[model samples]
Target: MESCDAALPYTLIGLVLRQPSPPHRGAASCPSRFLRDYASRATNTLLWICLISVTSLLCRRLARLVRLWVQGSRIPGPPSNPFLGRSKLIPGCGSLGSLTGYLAELHEKYGPIVRLWLSPTQLLVSVKDTMLIKEVLIKAEDKLPLTGRAFHLAFGRSSLFVSSFEKVQKRRESLAEYMNGRISVRANIIPSEIVECVMGRVDTIMAKGTLDCGLVSQQLAFYILGSTLFGDAFLDWPKASIYEKLLITISKDGCFWASYTIPPFWSREYWKYKHMCKRLKHLTEDIIQHCVEKYDLLSKIGHSSYKDNKDIEDEARFNDSILLDNMPSGVLLQEEMAEYLTSKEELCGNILGLMFHGCLATSSLISSILTRLALHPELQQKLYAEIIAVQEKTCKLDSDDVQKMNLLMATVYESARLLPAGPLLQRCSLEHDIYLCSGVNVPAGAIMVVPLQLVQMDSYIWGKDAGRFNPLRFLSEATDHIGTHKKYEDFEKTAFLSEPKRKAAFLPFGYGTRACIGEKFATLGISTLIASLLQNYEIKLQPGSENDPKPIMSDCLLQQLLSSPEVVFTKRSKRKTWKSKGSS
Candidate 1:
């Protein structure tokens, strides 16, 4: 074997060193070396493939871990996908309101703070709880807001709705003047005047003999804001009209799909919404600028006129001094006003939010009241009789006549109890702690909320037969149960101011600093509209328009708005146009 190996090496070396080996000879020799090279490359390729697979596996695991970590310790929710979770349910709902309904269902199934997946990140949701809602809403101030990225697209970052914290805080402080009691008194003058004007428009709409409460409600609200803000030209002025345009733009189906989502930033369509929101922001800023200039001009005139009169008559001089002292300074006022508008983006948000949410609900609620009256036209006649009786007592057909319509108020209350706007309100968590009422302790960052729908409909709160729409439920006996809700601190205050006993039940306006600031405004507006409208016209449902506004529920979106169809409007059925005060 040794002799053979030595002979082989010589032969091999000689062959390798040969003058000119055939092309394949050198290429084909040494099969072992070639095999070794091929094995090395193959091993490198296999190693790379293994590395990629492991890396990918690790990435997926990490993403899951982050999702879980964000969800925190005690939050409860359904199992989620690595991508979208219940967010996938959105496509099936058929409308924006369906999302709310779906969320409500989740509350029933999983309880509050249900972690929902939207693009791998879990967003915890709570239905509604007073103190907790306050923390996320008012108590923490704007630090922890309820809005997500989706809303910014519809509203824009420059908007009060989307402004940064410093900007918002500045604006909130300024807007406080408008909201506070003294400044509110001045602001009141404008809305009242606007209301007087819109009443005429309502008469015309009523004359058409057909109406969709949603459309009518929208028109009325916009008309008020427009006319009040910009005097008579709001309808024609481009800038003032931005309010209506913005509302319509955001309410579009596309905007609806995008705005409620937390990940609107990920969608290209949202970019368009974002761009327009920027334009809106610019428009608002420009309006503020223009208003400041106008105020300056007016001030110069006021000052020059004052100078002209300072040396004039005694009574006039005193009056001039008083006017100058009482009148708000244009510069300070403008700056303050801008600041207020800025901070009050939440206020604007809440206002728009209330309108978006309240329009259908209020309309539906009104329809329900009308329906109950229709079923018992005797009650209607009796209500009209009461109106007439009160009018006779006063012998004057005045706005005060509405105060005598006790049955109508009772009917309105019963309807509100039966079908409130939202079955629940939501509050997000800021810290880790146990919420008291339900005896549940959700972890930090865990959301907590109350099912207002369930609470309102609860037998314990409203009595065993709470489901029925009984106007009697609104009697003093009913009012007793209205504000006793754990969430009605504002109502408690109102009740406290009125009488010694503080026993009202479930407050629909909510509680704490975040309670509806416009409650008084809304109460005044609706009462005036209904009372005045009923003053001139009799309302009856369109023929064949019955119990359920639409036999197949249209979801909560318009559940309460379209309760009645084609309310008959025939010039008060030839009844006397003029009557002594309070006479029906």
Candidate 2:
């Protein structure tokens, strides 16, 4: 290829030489001096043009960089090398966990509100202060572009995780309505369904004697989510394992690729990743089609009419029958199909996102909680006692029973506090600057993060033993005092203190308008599984397994937790069990 500078001058010279030779004197009669002067002038003109263009380009880039530096300079953070920024802060190969840990360290050294520069153009501001975190989250509802791009290959453009704010909000509202209605109507049945699914997984683990709890828990979560999302239909899906494997692979690799901003077309491994995403999408479509066919959902949905307020109230009386008969398990009932989704792709994307989020986080959480339980047998007995009390109060375990067991809920909450599914909650301001009460203004396009784990584990906010695993801290009894009237008054005074602080600090699901919508459904399902497991067997760490480090929660972009600290499930000596209503 010819250089533009050289090509331009040569073309000008050729044109001058071919100008008809001035017609009269011809080429020979033309003075050599005139030709030399013209060529010299043309060369000079081209040289000056090239110089100005290069200088202008450089100046523009420099000005943009200067503006970026100025924007980040106002915030306190570790000094980074020019252009390279803080990329080296993350150790070898890097990971979501490593980045999170690095951010926490930065917050300690530099203040709660710290700035990080991934590059001259990419800036990240991490807020660990409770008040600031709440403000930033409330103000910035959009997710970072990097996160969206990372999972774009797998989740699709319309996924809840990647869509624009208005679209995401619209989709979320639609999904939330369906979820709220379904969960309310079937609340009692969900727990029993979860327990049955969990028991089957437990039987497999017990039969194996000493299996990796991570693998078993992964399968357990997958089964429960599959059932919850697709109902009994998923049990008959032949490619279920393949579907799970694809999800795991895509999720694990998406973060790494996103961190480096490596597009699929740029690497040799691109094909494999692309293939997995394609297969996952296809599988999702297949299951969706199967469910639609199984219930003749298309016809039913077509025939369904929009109910007015009075009709809705009347329908509420027969909600159970209407729900069960009109919709098959796991298939969402769309009030207005067009309003809820534009195409099957949108529905599939959301379904896949739901499955990915639920399976990865719930499984990891369940594994972590069980691992903690195995390590602390005394705690297990306490939890077991709580579960039994609830069971005794009711004939069979249900959503109501799950709610009554505060200690059980506390145990789950405590475990989540220690090992959160989302290590760092990320958001980006897209339209305007976010002004914090503390006078720090987060600029648009700058990635804002809340290091959820760091805040959750802060000793100052949670007392001296914040890092330790203690479920009682979450229970009301942990702060209760049975003493004089003065003590009760003192408790009343301090009650408001912790509640607001804890609300800001403890973010298991998240905060603000974008918080996880499936919190109640997930909690109920997890509690039921734990309760059912406790009823049949006692969880204990295998001999010498206690020496292994407790499994930690990874970033949401990767596997939630690896099953570690090998554990065994042995039948409890004295156990009480009841069959679900439909059980044989």
Candidate 3:
């Protein structure tokens, strides 16, 4: 059909030329010949112009691609296909495991900084070296275009996670203020809430005898975050299951779309993602509305206080613009900074982003940590002893108690290092070329990836036992020898890697300007939850379940750790299990 359309103009000219010459004596034939001649000339001229314009555009694109290819070739990497580039070598639409594995292979065969051609148009540079990754992360702020587009579709354009660089800075600042205010004031309440949530899960696990680690971890994370966002009302909310299901669906679909990069507008997957986003938005708004209505009675009765000091403070903050006063610190912070939120849509987007990002990452880490603990019972006993010691000192376990548990903190870091929730740290040089040390320059609009999984587990950096789950690796030699410290930070150097490379070597929460804002909260929540669980029950892998500790690397937000390891919660007895004070 396209060929026919192109030929139509030439066909008209041919027919006009083939027409029999008008009889010289007839005036009617003279006008007919004039019109045919004029039509043919105009058609021929238009066709030539269209052809020239198309050729010029193609030539220009070809030249740009060639220039990019030459620039990319300067860096060492596997040979790329001519027009296809490295698309065939590196799976664009494959799982995260495949992509990261391929990158690791390239870095091994080549060097730390290897050039990857995702397509003829898209050039990606994978940096596994800690030093180089630090440089790249510090300089790059924008997300990859295709990735940003995917996130924008799922979340709104004004979402804090996916926005322009300037908007991102503003959003980060606003969110930082909110996070800081909440953590400072509400720090006392969170650990107890986390413990309550985990203990509830433990009850269900005890009754069932066995449960999928993924499901348990996911529920715990959801419950914790839900409680913080919507307060106690969210716990009894009837539509909670539906909300969680929608979130899981949206998360999986979003990951797929982001990996596929650019799904056609008419594609089934694209429309399905769009449909899910609408459903998710409606559901999120409904949740917000329900919380508002539930809180309305408290506001009307002038009953400001709920439970204790924290509850009183929470009620006092309800007088602010935000409707969910019972939400305490996090919500109150947002309420206090109403000017930062421009509209309802942006607010909803931010809320959903918080739910999605917070729940997924925290859940994944929880699962990974549990799986590791279950597989290595010795580690669990050691950690349990540490928990016992801390429990002896405090009447109740909280964030302050978490700070005193050094091995617990090291275990969290070690689990994250071995199985990072976000396997790859993604950044984009969207507007300008990012110049790195040693004459290395990432071209404009290039995607910069720092494979955290590879870097974190590198033997050279973390020693021969890098693959092993050794929490002691994160502690200083003095702490390792002396047993315990008053605080986790008492160690001079926490990382096993020496000198400057140590901090950059382990980036479970990412690095630079765009590092996760909820690091402290996530750590506190995860550590507190683990400690409380240990206090009540001993975690063990279910009978006949494979205990493989290797994590499956993937392109999704959550790494596939533990291979669906199911665990049984065994209640701890009064008697001591191990002989040594804190020994397995």
For candidate 1, report its TM-score.
0.57
How does residue 504 of candidate 2 score in lDDT?
67
Compose the digit string of candidate 1's lDDT tens values, residues 1-584.
22322222223345466463334433444445545655677789999999999999999878755745554434565565536655474555432255545555665678644545444444445544334444444432221243434354444333334313444455434433443432222232333344445545556776775654444455555654443333333433456546557656764433365435365578787677666665655554454444445545554666666665644333332222210122234332235543333453443343454344344344445555555555555556655655555545653333334434555555555566565555444443343343445443443333334445555565655676766655544444344554333221122122211111122335455544434444444443444445444555566656665534531233332233234445553345444433322124
The segments of candidate 1 whose C-alpha lies over 4 angstroms from its true place after superposition are 1-84, 87-120, 123-148, 157-209, 227-246, 253-415, 430-439, 477-507, 550-564, 573-584
Highest lDDT against the true fold, candidate: 3
**Candidate 1: worst 10 consecutive residues by lDDT?**
492-501
Tens digit of lDDT per residue, candidate 2, span 86-167?
5474554233356777877777788989998877778889999888888888888888776677767666755466624754
* Each candidate structure's count of clashing pairs: 29, 1, 4
Models sorted by TM-score, best on top = 3, 2, 1
Which RMSD values do the candidates have, in order? 12.5, 8.2, 8.9
Against the reference, the lDDT scores of all candidates come to: 0.46, 0.68, 0.70
For model 2, state the Cα shift of residue 213 in Å: 1.9
Off by over 4 Å in 3: 1-66, 85-87, 90-97, 184-187, 194-209, 255-273, 299-342, 478-502, 555-559, 573-584
Error of 2 at 392 (Å): 2.2
